[model samples]
Target: MSREHWEPVTVFTGGLKPLPPEGQMTGMYKVRRDTPVFCDIEGLRGDAQGDRRVHGGPDKAVHLYPADHYTRLAELMPMASNLLLPGVLGENLSVSGLVESDVCIGDVFALGDARLQVSQPRRPCWKISHRLGVDAASRLVADNGLTGWYFRVLHPGDIPPDGALELVERPSPGMTLARLWALEQSHRPSVEEVNTLAEAIGLATQWAQRLKNRADWLARNV
Candidate 1:
């Protein structure tokens, strides 16, 4: 079978800084870079996370937000269209062609010299709303299934600013990140489906635990 590939339009990285309104530190405002960056077990060398508890780690190393989602986001929030741009979503790699619907958990890819595995779909947070200046921005992304995904470094190496992200393997071909996100967000999810996803290979530990907990809750309450 032929593998899928995509070239990132831009690579971005940023340090944590105090954001307004609450002065909470954030690393969600990244700027484009023109040079290659090192990708290690933690993440891009210079990338910083305001809160490590939920943001950065081996299971959530690199973030890739599809460039195409910006257009729909702009339409959804015309007032903040100016803020809806590539790299603004705090993604490390801003690329088009591949979106959540096309990517599945356990899928591995080669970019530059690094090997990365799809860990999970990004869980939209209040930071997104704060970054975009739209109170509904986070919810909009979640509802529309536009939430980008994170990658866990399987083989660390330097990632260049320009190159195609080539698929190396797909272990769970039918479990796309979009489907997982939808199932997870559904108010009344199926116990069987939740249990299956909780054991999905390459899925982040935290997400799997959450799914398992949800399954248990459903078993008792539903």
Candidate 2:
């Protein structure tokens, strides 16, 4: 298997106080994914936002920092147990050893008892600088694209520390994490334009469906 498709070895969670019940970690073990538990979709809360870090609800979300700067994030939190970068996302689960190319929108993460599907890549904002140190968040966004996502929980429950991690289902074509990132940036395209590009990229059917869903979402937001 490609390194991209490898199983997630380290799951981490981030906070001002990043360590958990005990110090059971390594470079392979970092925040969010590294932590014993994770949560999302509840609401935003953290030291950066001034709230204790906890798991579950819509407030919980996941974000990923990449391995390219292992030496740096490691140093920043040399005594920290893990590094939690800000504004990257409401990152409930911070993952390691996984690549963005390996995921897609609507792809489900099967933790056996439950699952989470990729929604979209995080959009950068000021909160990042607040959580991660001013310039650090900017750098993460520019360098790694933060390369993480929001996983809507299909089944909310305990994600056992000792268990299997599997990819239950791959999203349809054109919905890969990379493709969704590309499509999200395509705000100027017309329906015809999107269809043409979607077809050429084999995203026609999925893109059309996604577009409808996106339209509904945007309409409600407006």
Candidate lDDT (C-alpha), each: 0.90, 0.45
What is the alpha-carbon lDDT for the whole of candidate 1? 0.90
- With a 3 Å backbone cut-off (N, CA, C), the pairs that clash in candidate 1 are none
Model 1: per-residue Cα lDDT over 72-187, one tens digit each:
99999999998888988889998888899899999999988899999999989999998888999899999999999999999999889877899989888789998898897799
The lDDT, on a scale of 0 to 1, for candidate 2 is: 0.45
- The local lDDT score (0 to 100) that residue 36 gets in candidate 2 is 42
How many residue pairs clash (N, CA or C atoms closer than 3 angstroms) in each of the candidate models, in the order given? Answer: 0, 29
Evaluated at residue 44, the lDDT of candidate 2 is 21
The lowest-lDDT stretch of 10 consecutive residues in candidate 2 is 43-52
Worst 10 residues of 1 by lDDT: 1-10
**Per-residue lDDT over 45-68 for candidate 2, one digit per residue giving the tens place of the 0 to 100 score:** 231222323223332244434443
